[model samples]
Target: MPSLHAIIPAGGAGTRLWPVSRAGHPKFLLDLTGSGRSLLQQTYDRLVPLVGTAGVNVITGARHRDAVVAQLPDLPGDQVVAEPAPRDSMPAIGLMAALIRRRDPDALVASFAADHLIRGEDRFQDAVRQAADVAREGFVTTIGLRPTSPSTAYGYIEAGDALTAAPDAATVLRFVEKPEVDLAREYLRAGTFRWNAGMFVSRADVMLDHLRREQPRLHAGIEEIAAAWGDSDRDAVLERTWPTLTKIAIDHALAEPVAAAGGVAMVRADFGWSDIGDFAAVSGAVHAGETDLGIVGDPRDVAAIDSSGIVVTSGRAVSLLGVDDIVVVDTPDALLVTTRARAQQVKELVDHWRDAGREDLL
Candidate 1:
């Protein structure tokens, strides 16, 4: 019956849904799920019932402090933890684990991304509660969603006999990187495979133990950062040393080693969820006032016509003809027009634009 801590990593700058999701506005801030709440807000809201106000923590970038604060006003401002810069998830997770350790070393921390949409909160919460119960018993756990497609975008977790029944637990059999289409399909057919939900739960001490066993070097650095954690002049300490921490990902630094150590376990999730990685997915869920936004082509646009899959948005003057599967975002300063399938590659396009010195468009 120890207290539970929830760590939500909101530092990712989702570049795929560009123009709409730029440097200052990542995809997580968008009302993509049309849930009336943003993805980050949804993430924050989802935990309120489970953890209470005192148990949740949101870890985001210093750049996004205002956005997060404004989005989740219900949560206390002190609950929000901001990173000095983008150092990837590992450092962010490591830092939070250390800070939380100072407060309660044996506390069970449930960590997840801030930008995912889930259709079943009850199931998700059920799975999290189950995981927390296991964490209380000293297990490092992650919730893995059942995959409906062979998505190359996600890293897959192969949980052999893990959690086959009620309150079940087993060791991780393999950690598979994003694979080729053929192999992904093969994994889908294999009952043991599960999509990495980017969700994890464990005691801070367990994670520190993981760092010591699998990634000692990163662990030592993280411990140093923890020892240095204080608010006497937190800004000064964070600014001076935050950049020194390595930028490796948590999966690379910790999950891989945990899997290697045969202690990693996953719970099969029954929630309906999506990453909402692009505008196409975002547009599918927006509600543009009801009557003011006319349905021009595609029905999902909140207003689209014969354009079955075309996402078009604008005032009364906007129109589309003979177009399908194109994402047309109409903002005053910038417009994003691209095929929905290629949306994932837009980050590379952003790099290209930056490399070409087109900061205006960026």
Candidate 2:
């Protein structure tokens, strides 16, 4: 296999997992899985095998640059590209692609989010290898997770004809948004849809060419910034030009349109994966081996009596009695109490805090 560079885009507040996940310390920086490593660290660990530490690059917001760097000390300082502000995934990944092309024009770049959990490392690596092989053939490839259930929480990618060049690869027919419960069930029964895990792979030049044709202004701005990347005027050019660039996701800016024009491919990923988007997912992962309750903090700090829910404590002891399917997160400043069913709506609490002028809690 040819040399493949990995780009990790790590920028999200993870408001749904508030109290523990705040603006200054987001989900990617937290050890939500009790594995002694942060989500970003785990992401780096997974990619280091495919592409050596030198081939991996991380793009994050300027505010969290220090934290990201501190967590991944082995990564080269220059590889951590800090954006002046958040312009979503497109600008972040595009900037990394431009920089990679500058260094090696024939480089194959694979972009993955920094906040996700995956079991079965061997399978994951195999899927990425296949995706890279497909991408080298000039197709924008994405790793599509095999749907295990009728999940309404994730978007779906419909697979079309199988590719002759790479048998494991398929033509991506379309990218569908999150559908209703019944529609999700229908999609599950169809056997042609896969969960959109947001894993994209493509050659740096091919990606840049698509961006130039699809989003001309964004393409031009990133090119200008990439041209001045190694020069002393890089910061000056970025500060003046970044804010003026379009703020859109890679899905809308590149993937969807490219798929419609027959330039997208999919690789079936049969490994266990979770974006950990909410407390429900956290609870499930933490309690996968447990009998009833899930405890995130120190186990000795929690005492459960007739309770079967998730409990996260800071320094204080938390006691629960007769509670079922509940979520309790206790931090030094804020505490969250809700049921697992409403875990997806925890972002509303963050919005409420903002409205009530309680920025400190957030």
Candidate 3:
């Protein structure tokens, strides 16, 4: 029953979902679900009940400012926190704490990733409420998704002992990085494993306290940034300081630390959530029944050429021949031709192209 705010990290370029999704346009902004609303906008709408129009804060890169503003126009333009350099999740987490602390020091924050998909809104909102309560009690609450498959694509969390509220909720024994196929299968069979959905609920004051105690350098940098908070010349401050910040993730800098210290709690979320992290994940959402045209194409103009599998088009000419079990995505400037099984590796391909200095291809 306290003041709540939502901090959304919307800085991903979604290189894995390339061709249709590019550096200029990431996966979160696309209505890949064909739900008439984009992922980020959908998240914003869901968080509005707690964060409201003005209370929602988004941390993003300066390059994506116009795109973010275009979606959340009801929000004050200044509320958008744009990083000058490429700092990792730790800095972004720090940035949100600093900014939100200035406005409401005691505010509880419900942090979310912009690109995730969740069905069953009632269950999702209920889980958030429970997490918020735990945060008010000064515990960092993270949602642990019940793994439906032995997916090596996601990191796994071993459910620990039971809690008062969450009898089924795991204590989050240890955070595992992406595992091998065999280990992932082993975990699925073990039945106590859950995927870390990267959602965090905590108070600005409490998280700042933990960061100061645990990550001193990051704490100092963010503290300085917060002290220099509301000046009109914001771009000047970011350009001077953000590049000096470290490139650590919040999971490494904060969550893992708290997890190691044995103070974090996991809430069981059965809301049918998917990270929608790559092209394959998107395909799973858009692909329909085989006999039903099963593929979603621009009705105005879709002339299939012996294509059996699902092919989605956005008003472009798609000529598919003998393509099956494949998701062919055509964007304004790029194209992604990949099988469903290999969709998770889209980020790796993006990185490969980036390493090759093929930014245009990205």
Q: Which prediction has the highest TM-score against the true structure?
A: 2
Q: How much lDDT does candidate 3 score?
A: 0.78
lDDT of 3 at 57: 85
Cα RMSDs of all predictions?
3.5, 1.0, 2.4
Regions of candidate 2 where Cα sits further than 4 Å from its true position? 288-290
Q: By TM-score, is 1 or 2 better? A: 2
Residue 331, model 1: Cα distance from true site in angstroms: 1.9
Which numbered prediction scores highest in lDDT against the true structure? 2
Model 3 spans with C-alpha error above 4 angstroms: 165-170, 232-234, 292-300, 303-310, 347-358
- Each prediction's TM-score versus the true structure: 0.90, 0.98, 0.92
Per-residue accuracy of model 3 over 1-362 as CA lDDT, tens digit each = 66888888886767677766777787778887778888999888888876688778888878887898998888898778887766877788788877788878788887899888888888888888888777787878788888988888799877788776544454667788889999999999998888889998888888888898888887887877877776765666667777887788878878888888876778888788888877667766664655323355564455555454446577777776666667777666656677877777767767877899988887
Worst 10 residues of 1 by lDDT: 288-297
lDDT, candidate 2, 1-362, per-residue tens: 55799999999999999989999999999999788999999999999999999989999999999999999999999999999999999999999999999999899999999999998999999999899999999999998999888887899999999986565899999999989999999999999999999999999999999999999999999999999998999999999999988999999999999999999999987899988888888887785345478889889998888787688888799999899888999999899999988998999999999999998988
Reference-based lDDT, each prediction: 0.75, 0.92, 0.78
Better of 1 and 3 by TM-score: 3
User: Can you tell me which runs of candidate 1 are displaced by over 4 Å?
Assistant: 163-168, 283-303, 310-317
